[model samples]
Target chain A: MGRTTFHTDPVEALAGVADGDTVLVGGFGMAGMPVRLVDALIDVGAKGLTIVSNNAGNGETGLAALLKAGRVAKVICSFPRQADSYVFDGLYRAGEVELEVVPQGNLAERMRAAGAGIGAFYTPTGVGTLLAEGKEQRTIDGRDHVLEMPIRGDWALIAAQAADPMGNLVYRKTARNFGPVMATAAATTVVEVRETVDLGAMDPEAVVTPGIFVDRVVTS
Target chain B: MTAQQGLPLDVSGAAEHPEPLDRAGLAARVARDVPAYAYVNLGIGQPTTVADHLDPAQGVVLHTENGMLGMGRAAHDDEVDPDLINAGKVPVVEPPGASYFHHADSFAMMRGGHLDVCVLGAFQVSAAGDLANWHTGAPDAIPAVGGAMDLAIGAKQVFVMMSLFAKDGSPKIVPSLTYPATGLACVDRVFTDLGVFAVDHERGRVVLLEAYGTTAADLAERLTGA
Candidate 1:
């Protein structure tokens, strides 16, 4: 309805996030993670948060740091345990954190479904595995598929290589993982970028995520 | 030589028996089967070793679940790109013509059955071709089931890389799986330290295709306890 505002301060951009809210942090391992936004969230000290991401971060960088600060109450991710994910491992083993292990494909689809306004969908990804336990099942075209619900977040923290004045974003290389899907799946999407340019500076053809899905942009 | 040409068996010692191939040997055996121009996805663990054994001239393209196609071998300390890692979170190199996409699109490639073959590590594979490798359901087990389920059912052909027997000498290829199942009748072939098995899902039987250090008869006997 109005022009998007760019915040130079990460905390001011992420001030809308409250405690005990579902937050989606976009990244695959350490790449594409909103590090500055995460650090800002740490400064905000929002506790009892639910984090959804591809990983639990390798070390105390992004999601791992939030967990180490005793902010995260649960983590829903594809891979929660890595060689350097000692923070999650220790907290999980000590019964301090809850975890929901979703298959990578299903995780992406769930987020995409939420963004697309799809209520639910059936996928053959985890049909006969433990991930299918207690979920609805059906046979379609003589193949087994498990029903998965859409995943929506109260807020989404994303990282992009460049952002236009209107909040249109572009990501670099493999670092683009989960950024687009998450940009649309959250109630409020805040993006961290290296730089921002004029509205007409970016070619429409090169825009991966339109400004319609983004709420705020912060340059770090 | 191909794995079909079984290794020599020691006959001088009456009590000495043939030793199974080590992890590298098993990986080489799997790598030799990858056809040229094939788009392959190598799972974590032992299956990743297949990439190292593959001939660079084979033209085989590697795919990682995190969304990179045309992936190359594991990166060295100096070449490691922190942002470029495989599904295992291990650093990797991007081969020529490599492309990266969104996570959803990558899964679409896998679930849409665009890959020619996917090599995965397994705990147990039944004679009927059922695979169970994700979780053992042990209290101490973390139950991290990354992309194995998608790869197991989505790949055009699934090849499992594991040892013929567990550390306790119990056969991993059994008449029926004792652990939780990952996929039903999805496994096409299994490469083990001892031999390769072609699963006849229609007949619910396993056929020994090749062996490393033992005769087919001896391996069959060990498999069926004849």
Candidate 2:
């Protein structure tokens, strides 16, 4: 018989994540976050989570909800400016959250590297100043660059517009922002899709992420 | 006697002639307008080209969001140090007295509005002065909202540098922006390939200040569909 397992509800799926577990979330300013799953994660009350997202959503939504709940220990992203009312600044000022940022391009590449199973790559992105702190700096052919390690998550929470039961997914326009990369870079790739279909139902031309990387699916 | 015999003091060379406009000349013109002794942020690409033309005597302190202040222009090929980079992570030279700080501290300066001027490149500038530089609705493109959003609202004076029309001849300076905004009603002035215009904050209009060879009517017709 073909392998089979029960699909888990969002709350139960995320319940066992301990404090300080690294979580990579997919979205670009409220575009593709698993809003319902995020709410369930908040309900799970996991603290000290180091969240990786493109931008924190507004205070009442998604990742910002976790920030507001005082659950996120750190945020790693490209722009905190997208957060409503500058919550990142407030958290930083209050010592409630630590913040790290990569140039937007490098952030994407790092996620790609993580998914590709590469240990690290040298990029010109953060060679100088504080971004170089505690990282290996090397010079090649008379030019200097720092080695930034790839970021992998213990759990990847990704939102998709569509997902087939076998886990192939498709994202709407800007919703494709960070989903596909996070899907492969996490130990457990939990997918939340607006519509879920049976295996082999989605057209191969439309699939953004292949099914093999996904470990769970939640139909929003 | 020998000097006079060899060359009769070429008066033509001594006489000034109007040099044709070029990228460097345009950059110099932009630099000439930036007030001295101001904290300024320069964006990547075309806007970064403006630094090449900044007069050495001008006391403009450049800030890079990755935590360096007093960044100089691109270094000579022989002087390039890949270790010194700007916010865009391009190799750059640190000017004298350049300081480094934590990323959060750097953002604090921006959020606290310590920057006096920010020069940016834009894909679109709405007639109401909204900026949209990050996402352009391209399928192959990744929408990276860099420091544009912070610098858009953080600086007291926001100056945009871009071509008036995109390569396809569509007006980039528009009556209303279609892309997602970096900041709402935050832009102050625009310096474009066509001309310079001031944002009329109260009236929600773009007041033409100077256009190289075009008129306000012509610009209005192309940009506003007026």
Query: Evaluated with DockQ, which candidate comes out highest?
Result: 1
lDDT of 1 by residue, A98-128 (tens): 9999988889999999999999999888877
The DockQ of predicted model 1 stands at 0.66
lDDT at A178 for candidate 1? 95
Residues A91-132, candidate 2, lDDT per residue (tens digit)?
A: 776777877765554566577789888999775334433345
TM-score of chain A of 1: 0.97
Candidate 1 residues lying further than 4 Å off, grouped into runs, are B1-20, B76-79
Q: Ten-residue segment with the worst summed lDDT in candidate 1 chain A?
A: A1-10
Per-model TM against the reference: 0.91, 0.53
lDDT by residue (B80-138, candidate 2, tens digit) is: 65445666545667667887543334655664579888898888887678887866756
DockQ of 2: 0.05
Worst 10 residues of 2 chain A by lDDT: A1-10
Q: For candidate 1, what is the interface RMSD?
A: 1.4
In candidate 2, what fraction of native interface contacts survive?
0.07
